[model samples]
Target chain A: MKTITSTVMLASLFAVSANTSAATLDEVVGKGHVQCGVSQGLPGFSNFDDKGNWSGVDVDICRAIAAAIFNDSEAVKYTPLSSKERFTALQSGEIDVLSRNTTWTATRDTALGLNFAGVNYYDGQGFMVRKDLGVNSALELDGAAICTQTGTTTELNVADYFRSNDMAYTVVAYEKSDEVVAAYDSGRCDVYTTDQSGLYAQRIKLKDVSAHKVLPEVISKEPLGPVVRQGDDQWFNLVKWSLYCMINAEEMGITSQNIKSKMNGKDPAVKRLLGEEGAFGENLGVSPTWCGNIVAQVGNYGESFARHLSVDPLNISRGVNELWSKGGIQYAPPIR
Target chain B: MAKEESAGPPEVTTKPWNDPKVRSIFFQVVLLILVVLAGMYIFGNTADNLERQGIATGFSFFGTTAGFGIITHLIEYNEASSYGRAFAVGLLNTLLVAFCGIIAATILGVVIGISRLSKNWMVSRMAMVYIETFRNIPLLLQIFFWYFAVLRALPQPKNSVNFLDSIFINSRGIYMPSAIYEDGFSLVLWALGIAVVAVVVMTRWAHKRQDQTGQQFHTIYYSIALLIGLPLLAFTVTGFPLSWEIPALKGFNFAGGTVIIPEFVALWLSLSIYTASFIAEIVRAGIQAVSHGQTEAAHALGIKAGPTLQLVILPQALRVIIPPLSSQFLNLTKNSSLATAIAYPELVSVFTGTVLNQTGQAVEIISVTMAVYLSISLGISAMMNWYNAKMALVER
Candidate 1:
């Protein structure tokens, strides 16, 4: 043992830990795929179906990113992460972009060495209570026991809301979202609290869909969006504009079906956005047709919103999620 | 002396490996170098990685306000408390669960261990069944079953099952009447302390007198009386200063009483019951290690069955039991980390999960948590080792 150890020690003296730079865009292209981090499962956001196929609003962001880079929506891999592991995974460069429904908080963006590209879904914390409880608003939830998963923005949001409102509440926090749902379903707690969109999505999993009501009050702003690691500005811009391109396209009457017709349009904003007028994509280190690929492959923001969230299974109304042109806050910069 | 000189001179033609002194010195030097190098490399690696990431690699976060509310804490805590205080609350809660679990398990274990060796057929078989049922199943599942399935099946606050109008049981938790000590309670505590000291002095005198005069005294009965009677007397003299604050049903949960949260109950119950199974096995083996001949010999010497078992068999059996029993205690303490699974807000659940996520200081938080658990395990073993030494047999 002594001889073997000495030999290994002698050998390790010459070994080196080679350092690699954080060039996420080049790395993704070199690997021929974009590694995207997403939530474990949140319907209309990052849910996995029975066939192991991933879909939702967050998944569309990942696909748009892949199309922007590789011109193919399928050139992407999904890594499901929990709330606790999402930040570390991004920081360690294990995934290019965290496309989970992570809230863009000041601490997360600045302190945690992360950068929130842009808001994909504007939301806020809301409460879901049993209709039989007759709690119409959060003010009526005094002395209530709230059920929420720990280690997320929802827990802290509800905590802050209750403290500020001078209401006493007992929080029954579970580690898993499903556990929180089960606990709430089992009547272990009186109210279930999470993001407004999440409450709508998770309400479908409850025991009785019609028996619970989501209160109208939004207690905290939770601008859920994709996250990228800090110090990678080029990669940040790619992720930021990928979502922006979709939003701007939605404002420009663009959709996945009509993207081909608008490819050679005469409009300057339309031409520049579709790569016919300028070298914007070249400046961002991708091809000139990056926005076009994103629009053609992943659809516009409104299409994704209606498909995954608003009109279908999730049925979440686009409240703050609607385009700014339509009185919502989802405004993106013009392609010019 | 002559034979030794001859043997030494004859072994002059020796190899380095053949010499015990040289081999040990060489191995020690190699191991020391390896250990130091490994430690330095790890520290350097961590420092480098932290610096590169621009993370504040210090313990300054401990002093900052945590800005979070913990649901279960022994110490007074709020959102305004420092991170260090939050950590203290978590540590205290962990110790609370572990301490209660150890005491309960020890009592339950000894009873069941002895019952397993009972003369009646049903008692022994029942003990066997219990041990098998608990030890084979996973503890995490047991905690969840008790917490989610069984405990949640109880009634709500308005419909709570009341026990004599002092306690309330519901899905939320079990609320019992808490003692509200009024002023002048310290006098009662002083009386209890004095009574304990007197009992100790009496036990010593009894032991010495038995040694010198060969006469036995009712030391156990006297001690029990002094312990209970003095406390009661002090209470009566003080005009029942301790008042019972009965639980009252409020809007959602019962207020005013000391409500043990269902998470605490589930974690405590699961840990105690699960650990008691292993403890029962250890205790049974310890008793079995004491040969049957010892008990038979004591019986033949005119000692009663209870005294024979207690004085003769138990002392000997304990020597075999202490080592494994101490390990089981440590195991129970470490298993308290499973509190995270059921969200009891113990050390790991609160500190490692919430604090780490909030501060985004994974490296510092994880190492500190590890150090805490390590110290707890080491501390338990040290105390038990001292106990084992005390219980050890004296020999010339």
Candidate 2:
């Protein structure tokens, strides 16, 4: 009688644990696609094409997740959300993952119940002004009316920048990025401010790109990346490791075309990651070809960045985005 | 015979509790239970999820240092300030814009409403045009136009336009003379208060006399005299204490004077212009609602058009106007939330967006913001309702 009761108790414990983990993975697999929330229109990061297909550096992250799940990078439904609506949409389960250029801060991670997968871009706040203003440095912007977007860290940075310099400024704020850009172009504001990358993208669309210049001053640190809901550990791991695979793949000198040749490479880390040596895929509840599928399907992080942002007409250099071994900040953990 | 007739109803005798009223009560009870259960279930799920994720669920963050930045504020603030203080600043900024917008809109709305019925064709038509043009466009677009297109286009600080030797305008903002208090300033203030009280008493006396004797009195002229004469007399006795400190163009910007930033100006201008259109319509409708016979009757009694409006038309028109006008006031208060879109540090932008992001207390911040708006809306409507009741006509 005692043995029978103990067996039943053990069975119930396993049953409970099994039920909890089953729900998250089952839901994603059943849906057959991952829902990704992206920025409205930040060029080279996340923007819609003429065919209404979303494409950018951030969009690639979502595609990598899709490849890991459905083995098809195209199985992603993209939803464009504003900064204000992005987190709420995630919390409400409106989107499975958010790959907008969202900054990972301590408060957001702990307080908002979110898990940032990994940093995709290292950015900082910067200012832009017309060349005619003759403002060589940010300090010369004293008493200037600055056009900035609301609901961003840029707003607070404006106050701090002015106060620290013992200067005053009138802030003209708008809600949308387009409006801020338009205001700056119309001569309504003496200066426009945002992330350095955003300023570069916005400047290209200006009527005369050469007329305006982004200032040399970088005001604040903005480490932007993908984020997911906090409760789903399985989903978080899938996302976190998918990003890790990309970074690791680049560090291993594994490109999309070379992934097949490197499958039998002598490197233990590459073997384990590519499912040639270990059962890492089993632990993630995915097929053995998960990492290989992501590389073959979506390419590595460096490849995506080069194809979309760098070495293109935009020609954004990979200053901080390069692999750590190559003197950049991107360092991935060992897959083993 | 009555008992026998009553016994006929015994075939289907029913108790009060079995009636439709009782059934409705029981149904409502069930619905209430179901709703509570559903709410508790969702709340429980959320709490469990939060626990599993190791996210704290509480309002303790309100006391924590915001550590996030705010761009514009009416009060002193820093990243080290508590979230509570930040919320206070946001609430205050919202009230500041709403109060200014209401007063300015009311003044413009009244003038335009009166002018629309003017004998001069140009005046009425111009007023009509103003109302039509502003009323048709969205307030958000107007705010964007003012903040981005109009204010941004101003000259740089170096080339700011100087007006009246004391005021300056640039992309930065407007600078003008600030009041400077010296010795004996209180005497000037006391004199002004006394002048106002004197005018009020004289106006009351004039009204009483006119009601009793039916005689004409230049009450306006007498009231103006009492209001200005007493203040001037006191100023002469105590020596004028007030002084002005005009703003001067300094190295980079204006110095030694008050500065009104462009954000505040854009928000105030857009809100007033947008709200004035609605108020004008309310005023026109109120005026039109007064029967034509009332105006004709007043004129037949030898009353001029001005008095006919004041003594006969307005009192009745106010009865129709106060309710809708109150709604417009509430709407203006709510519409001020858009101030966030322009970084005016209004309630929604400051508390909901900035503080929430800084503190990571979304649920608490959003709840507080909603409560602030709800209270302001309720307070305005309550005051309006009281005034409406007082102004309503009494009919036999």
Candidate 3:
């Protein structure tokens, strides 16, 4: 009896320990696909199309990382998560990477046991109001009822904005983004607040699409990017540099269409980026042409922006999202 | 003979390992050790994982600022409060909704349950329809129906529908008159407490009188009068210490009166209505479990149908009712966690959802949230146990 009980106990303990191991670069590759956490549905950020294809800025980041690892963008799985479950999913090894539109906060960096890869989209918190309300600025929203998604930095930012301005407003919060829009569209709230890009993408879903205007005042900095669990430097560097390579490709005018032709350029920066002159890809534990794979599969950051947000569907201008060499704040460190 | 018995004890029947009693003891000791080892392994693994991930693993996050606003709170709260304060607000809101839901469900359940068993065809069929309609539908869908479909269809605050001169209805919420307590309100409240104690003593005396003299006092009427009369008398003596602040539409919302947010209304209504359907069935089963001969015997005496139910049937039926009713209460409290879906800011939505995100202490925050629900369930069971003891069919 004693031996039987001891054996059972040992077996159960092993069962638990087997599942508690954290994410590692080797584990992701061995699994044959990357597990990426994303939102349930957020237009132009990380949402599925009518044909069940994932296409958004955040989704592209996941694809780029997949391309870097497997050289096939389709070698990826998506786990749609709420804001509440996003971090836990990464921390518990349920996902290899959380490519959700998560902001990189100081506390999240130092305390959350997570590392943000890099900023794929630089957004600021802003408010959207009906044009009929005659509110063009957030300061004019003194007594307005606001709607926002819960479990987000936008909720706290709106609270701080109202308190600092001594405004008295009620908030009607919801868990899903569509619910927030539904509430606002139904006149349950006078204002809707989120990241500025979110405002631009979500405005089209309103009852009268052209009747709403985003307020002029940007409240707080919200640098949205992908995130991963801490303690895996190899995985962290792989995801971070994957995003950086996209930005670098854009800055160097290397489109997926032109990447193969540009690989023969004499510029040392271009040569090193394409893995012709250096072991940068080897340093990150991928194939020598990993940058080329990402570029060829998912295109550069500028292309993703144009395809998802800046073109026909969501015509959000690239104000602060442009590269530093241009007039915007998007700057990536040099490869060499 | 005694020497034989002692010598037989010394002679082992079998090896100690194979002996039944010895082996039982050995197995129990092994089980205890195994449980301890398993618990330690889990704890150590969790600690190691938390340390490696850089996530803080403690309750210290409760002391920091919450930096968020709740839609409704029973207690005072603000963005400046700590996460601890936010948790308290959430708990209070949960308790408020749970208590209200239980009271409403009990009243509705008993009424429908007694009516379901009615001999009248129309009454029974209507009760069955109500029960099946609510019980068959999913609760989350019912909540969404109330919130998104029913309440959101109301006109905006600027064009609110007036219920009366004192109350207003709008898309924001239902607004009504607010009661304001003045300086002498505590005196009236004390008078009401005194009246309650007096009524209890009077009830015991009346029971003894009936036992001895075979005569009944009008106790129900007497108790009601005493409970209401004393408070009103005190109010008159203290110069009417109650006032009203009637709701009127101001610039944006009705500012000075009490407002019930749409989330609370939807959650409370859906929970009470859905749980009432199940509770109605429980009530009917309890009534059916009692032998009909008991009621026939009461009717054969001088008792009417109303007195028969009040004096004989309900007391016997309570033994079956209390246990299941307690379970339903626990279910309601746990289901209150669904408040997160509608943004009600109950304990789960506020503490586990928002605070967990802000602090990034999923391990600690989740542990605390689970403990809260566990304690609530245990507390309800403890109270039910006491009631069950009182209702037990005691005999010598």
Candidate 4:
């Protein structure tokens, strides 16, 4: 029975790959929906609500791409994936784009045949401990039992941090983010470690949300972004530029509300981005209003981030994710 | 004249196509060829797809460092260990749980099975209730119930329930005093080994004497004395060289003692309880298959109920029990893969879940994992078959 199931799984895997010859863009058009992969449930980063709506920074990236191509932000189908299954789902063509809160790493980019379109959120690995544990800093977490999601760079990052500091710790890894959060919340682990943003997002799920605090130490750089299968330059560029267009729109202070007013503005960059100036969208095999559609539908990067993360429920500030002109490192190339 | 004519029979010739033997063999060969072709096609297409997808493929990733920590490992492993070493650690963890689960399940199953056969209505009904309740539920849900519901209800380390100040139970795990053997521990081990061998030889001699001279020797009493006394004597003579490392609440968790992680406890408990339910039914069926006349015959021969059960009924019931019991064992081992759902770091969780995701070598990792399971199952089946053959009824 095991043999039969594995054979069937492999057969289906091969069958999916047999259509790799069809361009990803063509396939998405034919299917009439962009299949976007996201985390099963990570609030403020691609979470599904009770009303069957998907929203978050990562989810918005996919929506922005859909808006750019189909001129409709709703023309996307979200596939929730666990950390372990995300890459496989993408490689098997189960998803055209993986917009999960996945960290961009060298091993994944080169070895796993994946490409990082661009960083949507700049993050860093951190620890969250119960306030009563009496540990204020990550340094005090020696000999601690840490819970983390499996198949993510957090595992390796935690190992490196503890080893370099000559500390002893134990890891209790779960395949899904919810399981890790549950284990940590149940007091099965002394510390919960992941991206700092994830710590905040998962903190909301705990029974006593105010009783936990994320540590101050940022162990590793985690540039969370969307990913696409390598080798399709056109699809890659479309996803990449979709994110770039949002950042550029935010940089030029052109948001969903003011995009129409600034469509005929004198600034060459603004005019070009708003589809009033050049053939920028045509080069990417999309309509002239590709950038305009993205801004009008999904809003600019700042607007999306503020709507999903920086506002009431999550309240995460745009610390390192703000535009470069605002002293943050988020920089995008000129549209002209 | 009729008898003489009957001496000559008509010559017969048959076509090979019409022959059943030839036809069966020919069809089998064609089937074999088709199967081989299918296997090759699957492999060839997978290779082509892998290349086209630009995913790296090879076994060299095993030698690379696996920078991840494990919660519980029987073998020595650190984050610095290679992926191969991590694989070994995961495999050892799997074997440990399977071995411990089998023992616990068999013991609990036998007790429950016997209880179901008890003359007491309450005892029989309670056993029936347990079997039905556990067997009807899915094993994964039972595992979650144990891990997330039961174990999760335990207190944290600071509020751990201490047993005699030596063992501690908490949400973290059960922490017990681990033995630290110093010099001269080997002498105690040697004494124990010798005692075991002596007891075996003495039991054989006692059996022979009972058969030939109609005399019984107290082998059990002597065996117990030899086994315990010899080891105790060695320990005392060696100046009591063993020390215990007791666990105590330190910064966050208990330190300096052997701790059984909660994941292992949950998995082991769930697997044992779930499998024992099925095994209990199997044992009940085996015991019931033995005829009631055997008990009556033993009673007529002036044997007590205890002796009748030990000598007559059980030995016969085992003949029915051994075959199906092996299947339950295999099921338990395979079901341990569900450990991946929780964080047990078993083969599936560590090697397939983590390693495969990190390396993106799904084909190699999954194939190795499946092969490992297959081998373990085959090994259990072989051992059970040998034991079944030995216990078979020997007829003169």
| Top candidate when judged by lDDT against the true structure | 4
Write one digit per residue (lDDT tens) for candidate 2, span B63-125: 887644455567887766887888888888889999999999998998888888788999999
Query: In model 2, how large is the Cα lDDT of residue B366?
Result: 63
Assess each prediction's global lDDT (C-alpha) against the native: 0.84, 0.79, 0.85, 0.89
Ranking of models by lDDT: 4, 3, 1, 2
lDDT, residue B82, candidate 1: 88
User: What fraction of the reference structure's interface contacts does model 3 contain?
Assistant: 0.56
Per-residue alpha-carbon lDDT of candidate 4 for residues B196-225, written as tens digits (9 for 90 to 100) = 999999999999999999899999999999
Candidate 1 deviant stretches above 4 angstroms: A1-20, B1-27, B209-215
* Candidates 2 and 3, the one with greater DockQ: 3
lDDT of each residue in A1-336, candidate 1, tens digit only: 112222322332222112125477888888999999998889999999999899999999999999999999888899987676677667666678999999988778777767899999988999999888877889988888888876798878887888898888887777778888888888778899999888988988987899999999999889999998777789989999999999999999978899888877788999988998889999889999999999888899999988899765578888878888898999998888
Q: After TM-score superposition, what is the CA distance of residue B73 in candidate 3 from its true location, in Å?
A: 1.4
lDDT of 2 by residue, A51-154 (tens): 99998889999999888888899999999886766776676566788999888888688877688988988989899988976788998887666778756777
List the lowest-lDDT window of 10 residues for candidate 4 chain B.
Answer: B1-10
Which residue pairs collide in model 4, if any?
none
Residue pairs in steric clash, candidate 3? A113-B53
**Model 4: residue A139 alpha-carbon error in angstroms:** 1.0
lDDT of 4 at B374: 91
Q: Give me the TM-scores for chain A across all models, comma-separated.
A: 0.93, 0.91, 0.93, 0.96
- State interface RMSD in Å for all models: 7.6, 13.0, 7.9, 2.5
Model 3 Cα displacement at B51 (Å)?
0.9
Per-residue lDDT of A135-253 in model 4, one digit per residue for the tens? Answer: 88999987899999878888989999999999888899987788898889888898999999999888899999889998899999999999999889989999999999999999889
